[model samples]
Every structure is written in structure tokens, then in C-alpha cells.
Target: MTDVPGFPPHTQLLAALARLGQATRMDAVRNAGPHNLSPLQADIVGLFRRGAAVLRQSDIVTALASTAPTISDAVRVLRRKGLVDATADLADARARLLVLTPAGEAEAERLTAFSDGLVEAVDTLPEQDLAAILRAGTRLMRELESRNLIPMSRMCPTCRFFVPDAHPGEVRSYHCDFVDAPFGAAELRVTCPDHEVRD
Candidate 1:
């Protein structure tokens, strides 16, 4: 095995752990359902699924650190598939809100099940190893989150803080309730408080 600098002899072990986690998530998405969601789609669904009670398209964009057009396309596709729904914002007459449909919720549950299985499998490992893995994974997540590398866009429609446009043709800023502010069109590089980077 090739040696990585600064990492100990267990580097391969670490790599294997990371790869297994990723593979498990991919497998979950693959086995989830007929949704046939792209990685982006899956991410978006995941966002909405987790935030079924309240979500919005702009929330998804901010979380994903993506452009409005990118999120709009994903939202359109999800809507076409009948996985998500958009409604007028009660407080803001100009904004619409996004949420998952029953079918979408079911699909999201399936994906969550897949993820749960992976966690259970990991739990079956030796206690020491499992503990180490947990600690390492937590550390890794913190480091990545600090770098804004986690996939935030996937949760677009599911984010509790998302606020969509009420009128289809009307252009409006994406409001993130979590951040208590709307994203400015020119502030693409600025990270919001709810930002979650997705790979």
C-alpha cells in the first residue's frame, strides 16, 4: 500500500472507513426507490425529506452554496416528478414555499432506512473500532463543515428555513429563515449561517 505522509500505519484503515461510509450512502440512494434521482436530486430530496415540515427552494440553494439557476433546475425536475410541491408564502405574498409530497416522503424514508442500515452495520463492529470510527468521523465532519464542504444543496427543498417565490415568473431573493435573512443575488461567495456544502 502507498504511504501517505503524516498518517500512521493505520492510514489504510482510515481510508477504508471513509470509503465504506461513502459507499453505504451511495448504496442507500441507489436502493432507495424508483425516484432515479441524480446525486443533486438525491441531495435535494434529502434536504426536503429531513425538513418535510418546512422547506424552500432558496433554502436549498443557500445550503448547497449553489446558484439560483442550478437550484431552480433541480426544483423543476423534482416538481415534474411529483416529488415536491410549491405553495405561496403566507407572510410574503411574493414568495413561494417548497415541500415534499407523500410519495417524496416515502422515498426519503427509504433513503434514511438505507443510511440507518449502514449505521447499524457499523455498530456491529468491535466497540473500540466503532468508537474510534465515530470520533474520527465527527472530527472529519467538523473539519469539512469548517471548510464549507458538506453538501448543503441536497437539502434545498427540505430545509425548514427555505422560502420560495409565490409567482412563477417573479424574481425574488431566496429567504433562509434559519439565517433570518434573504440571500442577495450578488452575494454568491458569502456563506450563510445555514450553509451546508455538498459534494
Candidate 2:
């Protein structure tokens, strides 16, 4: 979409982001095309690939920020494709846990690297741009997630241990109570595996 000349700066920025998002989806579709997987199926597989345990249908729905029926249908398709298997959870006799077959795991591995080329392209950008992207991305994710517009992320800003600009003029500005240390933007985590969400 072309940017409107008279549009405000924020509007223009959002438009650019929307274009990037569309491009990302297009890339995902293209990458998964050879595997005969839709973008959603690929995403599901990727999620499972990252996880160590089986996931419930509801877990898939919540993680993808999708509806129950939608995830159910996708799971059915995946099962039909022989990519996923369902088993009863020991903890809950009625709950069915979804696990990937060997073929599914292989496909998941492929899907995991779909954006590696994009990451290398992004690495060619300036350090300042990279820092700005990390800050802005986490802020936007936090804002959207607060309104339940998207899935939750473990961002430093919303983490209980995070302290912004703890040292005003110091090179290492932000503070992490978890580690009891200050860090610069380069070290700021947009998606911290150890982050605990602030209550």
C-alpha cells in the first residue's frame, strides 16, 4: 500500500509496518509451499519444535491467538498429513496432547529457519536501527498484548525485573533486577526466555 502524503508520522510508520507484515506472511506462504503446509500449520509446527513437551489444542489456540475451531481444523489436517499424533495426557485422562511425528519434526526444523535469510538481511542494517527495532517491537507487542489484541510475549519492559534508564547517563542504562545489573540497548531482550511477567 502507498503511503498517504498528508498522513501523520505515526500513521505512515504503521503503514510501513503493515506492509512489512504482509511481506512476512507472503514469505511464510512461499517457504511452506513446497512442504504443502499453510502459514498457520507451519507456525504450529514451529511452536511444537521449540517446545520440549506435547501441547494441548487449547494451548495451540492461545499461543497462536486463534479460535478453538480453527486450531482444531488445522490439527485435523496435520493428523491427516501424518505430521502430528494425538495421545491421552496422563495428568488428565480426557485431555489429548498433540505431538509431532518424525516427519513433522523434520518439517518443523525446516520451518524454524524460514526467517534465517531475513535475519541476515536485517543484520546488514545499522546498529542504531537494530536497537530501535528491538525497543519499538517490544513496546508495540506490550501495548497490543495488554489489550488482548495479540499473544503475550516475555518482553523486558513488562518484566518485573526490568528497570528503564536506571542509570540516566551511564552507557549501561537499563537495569535487570533478576541479574542485579545494568545493560545497554544492545543487551535489551525483546523476548527473554528468563523473563517473568510483572504482576
Candidate 3:
């Protein structure tokens, strides 16, 4: 609890994120239920809407930290509901790529509205607060990645194009070689479409 003495900031931040994540999931489920979706189904659809243009069943499992059976069940339900369809993976015939159907696109749009309140709340924060959280959150994600506790993110710092300021004589800049632009600590992309993971 916040009242606890000597509580680590990292622990407190993670706890807060956990609580917020649960609350957001609850809101998503309540709003999506009218459209005949369970919480997991809604989330799977969301991943399809935002994470990638096409995803494998295994990709969902990895992103959600979920089991194969769990993802499989949700995918089945989504397919049956005409929200998604599966096609043979051209790269691997044994695998299937999951794609949202037209109905699924509609559902994604509706879900976006359902979660608009959460977005608005975050957007209402002071600019400094927003910048602080984004920096801290990205650092925490990097730490988690180092410990193998989570999947590697597409954060700017991990990209091949990232050039962190090091020398005192330097301009103290964060540059992206790929874009030929300065990337400030607060303006870094959390999930970028063009992200190429560093080795």
C-alpha cells in the first residue's frame, strides 16, 4: 500500500499498473459483452487491431503470456462469431495467420470508443507527469526484458538506429539514423511499425 514505509518505487509503480490493467480489462469486457465477446476474445481482437496486420496463434500466446489452449479457444470463438478468419501461412504451411474480418474491424472501432475514457484520463495528465511515466515505464520494460520476464519491446532505445548521447562534448542527443531526426526521451515510440529488434 502507499502507506507502507520504505516501499520501493518500482514495486509501487508495478502494483499501480497491475490494478489499472485489471480495471481496464473489466471495462473492456463490460463494453464488449453486448457484442458477444468474452474478455479474452475482446483482447485477442484488440491485438489483431493494433499489434500487427497479421498474427499467428503463437504470437497471441506470446504477447498475452497465455497458454496455447487458451488462445486457441478464444480464436475459435472469434472465428465462429465471424470476427476473425485464419489463413494458411505462406511461409509455413503448418501454421495459420490470424486476421480480423470486416466484422472484426467494426468491433475494433467500437472497442476503441469503449476505451476512450481511459485514453482521455491519461491524456489529461500534466505534460511532466506524462513524460516521467513514459521514461520510467520504458526503463522498467527494458529491465524486464533483461531479466527475461517479458518479451522484448519495440522501444526506441533498443533499435539499431538509436544513438544515445555519451560524450560530454556532444549535444546530449538521441538520434534515429533511420529517420535522420532527434528523438527525445518523452517522444520515443513504445511500439513502432518500423522497429527492427537489436541483436
Candidate 4:
């Protein structure tokens, strides 16, 4: 579907991904708008899903691929809303760690399932398509991280436990030392709590 004449094949794929991202953003708006929170604000809350993440304003800027001023402004708004609090980082006196309040944690948990509709839509695709998309997405993420265009993601390719193509002839080729199990491309995780940096 390379509708853009004279363009490379990747252009079409990138365009398709952008469309999907737009759809997801609209869904985020529908869920966060009523609560007086923007999509980005909701995402900020969601970042604490693993636990009380010891994150600073700069860390959030990197994580979201946003500018420091933008994140700082957003943090100020969040603090005013009582959804988040910035406290002194025990390890670094000069840095302030962003923490979600009880209400903020509740909001974060709620936001986790905001993409349920998107997930259901994806589930409609055939297994082959799903696997292909997962592989492409993982590769794209890796490239972006390598270029520092995006922060390192908790995907299989960047994990200490990942062993790619460990079982070439098997249905599940990749190996994960963390669980001592083999998984296919479709099982690749984009944000895993158990992820450990490869280097």
C-alpha cells in the first residue's frame, strides 16, 4: 500500500504506524479528557505503573521524548492537581523525584486499561500479521534507542536475558534466561518490569 508514489516501502509502513498512533491518541483523549487531564498527563501517571518510580523531571523528558520545559510545565500542573508530588531524591540532593500520590496511583492503574479497545482491535488480526508487526515494532524501537532518538525501551532486544535466534528451526526461536523459556516474535515485550539492561 505504498500510495505515496516514488517513495520507499518503509514510508508506507511508517505512515500506517502513524495512523495507528493517531487512533490511540484519540482514545487517550476520550479517557483522560473528562478528568481534566491531557493525554500526556495521563501518560505521566501511567509511568509509575511498576511502582513508585524514582524519576526526575529530566528523566520524564527523556522517557517521553519531550522537551525539558514541556515536562517541567506539565509537572507543575500535576503537582497543583495533587495527582503527583516531587520530593527530594535520597541519592541525589540536587534532583527531585516525581512520585504519584494515592490518587495518582489510582489514576495510573485506570489508565493501564485505557487501551483495551486498541488491544481488541489488534486481536482481530491474524497470527502471522501480529507476529510481523511485533517484530517490526521491536526492531524500530531498537534503532530509535540506538540513535538516542528515544530512551532505551524494556524490549527483548535490549534485555540481558535475551538470546535471539537460539532455536532457529523451532516455532519459538528467542530465549529468555530470566524465565528459562523460548518465545516467538509475537511474545516480545515492549515494557517488561523484569527487564535488566543488556550492558
Best by TM-score: 4
Q: Which run of 10 residues does model 4 get worst, by summed lDDT?
A: 46-55
Off by over 4 Å in 4: 1-6, 50-52
- lDDT (Cα, tens digit) per residue for candidate 4, span 1-199: 6465676887878888899889988998888743588988987887778423667887788778899889888888989988899888888898899998888877877887857778899889988788898898998898888788778787888889999989999879999999999999888888887889888
Backbone clashes under 3 angstroms, per model: 20, 0, 0, 0
Q: Could you give candidate 3's per-residue lDDT for residues 106-180 as a string of tens digits?
A: 887677565667778888988768767878888888998889888777787788877767333443357787887
Lowest-lDDT window of 10 residues in candidate 3? 164-173
All candidates' TM-scores? 0.58, 0.79, 0.79, 0.88
With a 3 Å backbone cut-off (N, CA, C), the pairs that clash in candidate 4 are none
RMSD of each: 14.1, 4.0, 3.9, 2.8
By summed lDDT, the worst window of 10 consecutive residues in model 2 runs over 186-195
The stretch of ten residues in a row with the least summed lDDT in candidate 1 is: 184-193
lDDT of 1 by residue, 65-97 (tens): 788899999889989999888999998887679
The lDDT-based order of candidates, best leading, equals 4, 2, 3, 1
The candidate with the higher lDDT, 1 or 4, is 4
- Model 2 whole-model lDDT (C-alpha atoms): 0.83
Candidate 2 pairs with clashing backbones: none
Stretches > 4 Å off in candidate 1: 1-18, 115-124, 151-199
